[model samples]
Target: MKISPKKTSLRGLRIFCVAAKYRNYTLAAEELSVTASAVSHQVKTLEDELGLELLTRERRGLRLTEQGARLFRELEPAIANIDGIIAEVQSKTAASQLRVSVQPFFASECFVPVLEDFTARNPGIEIFVDTSDETAERHPVSADASIRLFRQKPTQLESDALFPLRLIAACSPDFLKRYRKGQEFTPLPILVHTSRPEAWNIWSKATGITLPPATSVVRLDSMIAVARAAERGVGAALVPVPLSDNWFKYGALVPMFDEIAELPETFYLAYPKAKAEIAEVKSLRKWVLDLFQE
Candidate 1:
């Protein structure tokens, strides 16, 4: 029987390929976001149009008939190639626009300084940086990628470790001088990042320096605020190294102790695993890994 081009449904053929590959209508339906009945109907329509039986349903699940297997063998590659071409086209279109979510601290201290370099290199890509702590922490679906601190590697997302977060106890020069006591800063108030309230405790334990009893804790929402508070002598704060390098260099803050508290958390550049190979994602991943990884 000759198949009529007008009568044949491309969707039906694609459904048949999926049904054949999985050998189960339900499975195919799940992948295609359709009902099993819909999958069955599409396959049946394809079989009628081709005048061939593509599948034989059995008690165990599903089985492909000889003709169905042959059709699948031929059509799968074609469908995959077509899918690839479509993805390529879409990727190129998306390559012009990129959205990245970043932690506020990283945005101000690290990313912004070097953003011009990336823009200069990829002039065609218009990148939007969202520096909201909420978006950076949750890694919302809208963002193409996120740069955030993670204690454990994110298993669900494709990620590259950028750098370990080493926090140092820091205070304003005046605070350090006032509190300095034979290599130990006297128990002054501890400026704490609200997200990591235990940061000072961790630093104290790591360095074997006991936090004084009745030490006041002033909680702030972000690392930048903590750094700024410490710089202004509000309290001695635990500040992430490298990100706070400029603060130390410019004499805004000085290290209270030589020891560093290397937290379990590390900064990571992360994106959906499925987007790993997309042109824009790939470019951003490479650029970020190269720029930040140590």
Candidate 2:
């Protein structure tokens, strides 16, 4: 079976190689963000083309069959060549303009609306994003700049404070009037992200308002999920000020109380120590800082 490049994806090859080397489909799946079955399918596809048994399955996990070890050793150079090509492409792209990584929800809610505005102002630079739930430790070091929400001096990166963070209690206003109409704001489901487990407690402490033991407390992994649940009247969510403004403006959710807590937290514009000197990166950093100035 001749494996044509068009017939198979590079992803299948990479996943197969990683699984064979590690002898763990689960580990390969974790790295690739897929199910174990998906990894198995890719590896099977590779094995079918090569006419070989890649692994012998065990109750614990995979153990390499004789053919698998030989295949793995031979494939290492192919993998390294692919990696070099990828790095070359990325480096060329990186040199041309700005590469920014931002927290996903914040990018959608806060940064996106004004994104074209930044582009308009800085016509010389192009922007790319590596958006995710949160910044990985090496994230700032990897990109020209990062838009992040947390309060810490990232090692080696220069940070310009964007805004002091504001977290507010919010829910669908009509939900309040309809579901819990006559009752005091006591019993209501509360949606909190895992990042801020004590949000309600902190807000209550700051405002000196004792909310009744919550009717429901659901933990979510993302602010977007928390905000969406609150929009659907599934629960109340503590949302950052930057996000709340857009949601309320669009009639998605309403601030439950006017009292906002200034989280000892802030979002910052951070860039790698080396990349900060690049013209495109510097322009974007200034553009972001000017938003706060206005």
Candidate 3:
């Protein structure tokens, strides 16, 4: 058997390998940062130069011809070996890196402590903090993970149920005294969350306070704002239980309504759809779930 020098080229072989592994030229193009047409042309050139059909194009997608399948089986191990060698070589020269993003409020109150544990264990890991609603959606695979607070299902993220939390009304001591008077604190003036305007609405329904006045509401876009306002005796805010831990500990704020308002919110550890289950990621997820043990 004569080896045809013109039959095989390394560059064409790599492209064909990716297309074969993914079973789609478009996806292979995406990974290779070239267009589908370019990948298709490369595959075409390879088949023409070798005088063999590699793929049968179908309406659904490309399928490897029998000849191509035999070739692929023979080539797969070589490709994988090259990949392993490349990884080994790069590992010796580069630092390990992981980037995680989190919602500001959840990061400040809930996730940071858990992260402290991670850093203590993973001193070599460099972390990046991103605070943006876009990152919240998990688009572009920007972060390794995120902790989000939501009343309903958060779109575009693969989420794990960390904890279902209840809300409580809280205010500074001065506000309670100023507004409670000698009336035994019946019908407390409300502190409201700005983002969730319905917080007051939910509280009213829970306490059976029929006919609540429109003037009895205060709103702020962020929980931190509402927490600060309530801490300053601005008004009582219906803040979620976990987020109020700091204020509750320092006596800066205390619960107003003795009856806890159960909200439809849950804290979730969300990540890119692909990265949700690796060993380190799973460790962090379980650590978070354990953080809020009942």
User: TM-scores of the models, in the given order?
Assistant: 0.68, 0.65, 0.60
1-294: candidate 3 lDDT, tens digit per residue: 978575478778878987886678987776466899999999999999889999878888899999899888898667656654654554456665556667667777776766778778767766676654422222223456677665666543567776666787778988777666563554545656555767777777877644334346666767778888888877767777776788789899877657777767676677644455444556666666677534
lDDT of candidate model 2 versus the reference: 0.74
The residue-by-residue lDDT of candidate 1 on 163-183, one tens digit each, is 998988888999878888876
lDDT of each: 0.80, 0.74, 0.69
lDDT of 1: 0.80
- Judged by TM-score, which candidate is best? 1
Better of 1 and 2 by TM-score: 1
For model 3, where is the 10-residue window of minimal lDDT?
A: 133-142
Clashes of each: 0, 0, 3
User: Per-residue CA lDDT of candidate 2, range 221-274, in tens?
Assistant: 988889889998898888888656879898889877788887776787887554
User: What does the lDDT read for residue 78 in candidate 3?
Assistant: 77
